[model samples]
Target: RNDHMLSDWFRKNQEVRIYLGYAPEPNWWSVADLVHVFTGKIDGISPSFRNSMTCKIIGRDYSAPLIDTSFTVAYAARTSSQIAKMLAGKYGLKLNITDTSEIIERDMYQNRKEWEVLQALADLEGFICHVDKDKTFHFGPRQESDEEVEAELYYRSRLKSNCQVDFEDTAIDVYNQITVRHYRKKQVIEGSAKNDALIEQIGQVKERVIYNSKAKTNAQAKEMAQKLLPEFSRYVVTGKAMNMAGNPNLFCEKKVAVKGCGRFDGNYYVERFEHTLNSSGFITNLDLTNLRPDTAQQYRQDLYTKDSAILGSGNKLGSGTI
Candidate 1:
């Protein structure tokens, strides 16, 4: 049904390259104006419904070498970082791996996808692993320090002019406690960590257990457990934010902040994000995980005062604010 060689514009397996740039803000230009954001192949094309006959094109990056390619036999590396490097080399992909030098007694892939093996390695070392734009692969411990955050987003309902979030989920992942066990030689070491703030907010117990970890000592086990805490309890506070500011500086495995939203204000890790720009407008959609659920604060009414009641369940005048 294609006319004027519409289907010819996108051939099967044809390489598709996309470059994105923020429209200059009032005659502002910079050296890094446009970026080569995507490199992939044309997957499909659909009919253009409008008078202009805009073709609906779809494509995906060759980001599946790790996720789809699998091999048999066991290959061992002294360090998980080394294993990641070996995979990156074998796959001819770029790497940004970090802090995976922990020693594992017995760990090797047995006929599994490269990505699954990477995921298992990450879980063992309390890290994160993924592929991003430009077919760049990443493997690293979760970002927790504020100094590493790339963006700070703000949204206040009162300030309708400054809109950043379209949909926000204050509470979702409920695992508040984690227990990790490490088997090293004949000695069996175990440690546990808790999300005190989440427990305070939900007033319940949600537990998780991790086995065959990279923890060596009891302290290391506890520390690893702590490092792995937010992945469960604070990782998924907000679902997706439609960037109102048209910012395209977002990336996965990085940290972003949402503020001025009570009980939901905290730093979030970008699990997944994408930027869509066209003739109509530009939008950067973000799938974030809450990193600092503890930052959520509460205000209570004074019990002694006649103005407000004490802390109690809702439907009562003496209840507290959440």
Candidate 2:
């Protein structure tokens, strides 16, 4: 099954690296976004604590440049999913767009890249895009669950090293009034959805500029601003958690609770995560943010309900009574 998915393009373009582990089995291969280009030992040194294998892993998104193909798009009224499909189709990539946005009279020039255009559309609609393990491209919000804390990490106990949190209040990140100008349209659209909240917190007016978009109406521009306001509200708390034990389920876009510290003890969303395993031990590092979940998605709750029903039912093993 896996061999069938590896086409001639992938075999020729994708990088391959061999890692010799303590096993009698043959080499294990996986198609990740990035792979190891080189792996071996240091110069004039045998395998020891300081002389581990030196592996260079490159990012898997080498195909990003391929998606940078330029083309013109003159859209009168088009949904974001349709535009995304057109972009993904250019590179023979599959898209899993769970949400959509709308645009009117959008025009794309030859200079702009398809990835950049896709990112712009995603930003306008509060969505994200990334390729998955199965090479399926996903476009949607970061999925969340009802669980208050996805995992727990202690500072001096679970963590091998120290953890630090930093606070930022840059004016460029937060704004009250945002004026957007279309590339071709003559009208200027202003969005002040949370003006009162901004004044109450910062006690002053902060203006931001968002110009040269493809929006064709005041409504579309306002919608873009409305979505951008919450994202740019600059009261961000970010931190680095180092040397935690390995957890397979921990990754970006998940929430975790941090304690054992006076000032930085709170719930944080994982912005980045990396886990590595070797002969020594497993290490997990995390980059977390203060963005909390607004509400749990319905699908997540449905999964819990199904789990409870299955566990509570007292039927035999294979009675087909799930």
Q: Quote the positional error of residue 273 for candidate 2 in Å.
A: 2.6
lDDT of 2 by residue, 118-156 (tens): 656554444555554344666566565534577886665
Residue 192's lDDT within candidate 1 is 89
Tell me the lDDT of model 1 at 160.
49
Error of 1 at 283 (Å): 2.2
- Report the lDDT tens digits of candidate 1 across residue range 148-267: 777767776457434456444444435799778766655788888997888887899878667535677888778867887776665344445665555556654457777777777777
Candidate 2: where is the Cα deviation over 4 Å? Answer: 1-12, 15-57, 62-68, 71-77, 98-101, 108-110, 146-148, 156-172, 176-191, 194-204, 207-234, 292-322
TM-score of each: 0.67, 0.57
lDDT of 1: 0.59
How far in Å is the alpha carbon of 268 misplaced in model 1? 2.9
